[model samples]
Target: MKLFQKLTPKALIFWTIGDQAGKVYLGILGNLILIFAIFEPAKINYARVLINS
Candidate 1:
């Protein structure tokens, strides 16, 4: 979670820079990739744990 907290700011900064550079589509794609790679798995694992519990 702490790692995510740190990464969130960095990601936001990068996304902002990308957007300012007129790479909006690429920024959105990158955000989606990050969401799936990081958040989606955590969400699935949390749901599984809740169901098991």
Candidate 2:
């Protein structure tokens, strides 16, 4: 619990995405990741992902 408290602010700033709309958007992103992982094991293991800020 304390650990979560310490991390909460950082998570809100970097991970929350946004509001209710953002929640749905993140849900879709998570679902797509799950589906891709299940169906594309080789790609998941080998693909290089680069996130641009």
- Best by lDDT, which number? 1
lDDT of 2 by residue, 5-36 (tens): 77767676665556667889899999999998
Off by over 4 Å in 2: 1-18, 42-53
Give every collision pair in model 2: none
Residue-pair clashes, model 1: 0
Candidate models: Cα lDDT each: 0.85, 0.73
Question: Where is model 1 more than 4 Å wrong at Cα?
Answer: 1-22
Clashes of each: 0, 0
Q: Candidate 1's C-alpha lDDT?
A: 0.85
**lDDT for position 49 in model 2:** 48
Taking all chains together, each candidate's TM-score versus the true structure is 0.50, 0.43
What overall lDDT, based on C-alpha atoms, would model 2 receive against the true structure? Answer: 0.73
Please write out the lDDT profile of model 1 over residues 1-53, one tens digit for every residue: 77666767779788778778777777888999988999888999999999999
Which residue pairs in candidate 1 collide? none
Cα RMSDs of all predictions? 15.5, 13.3
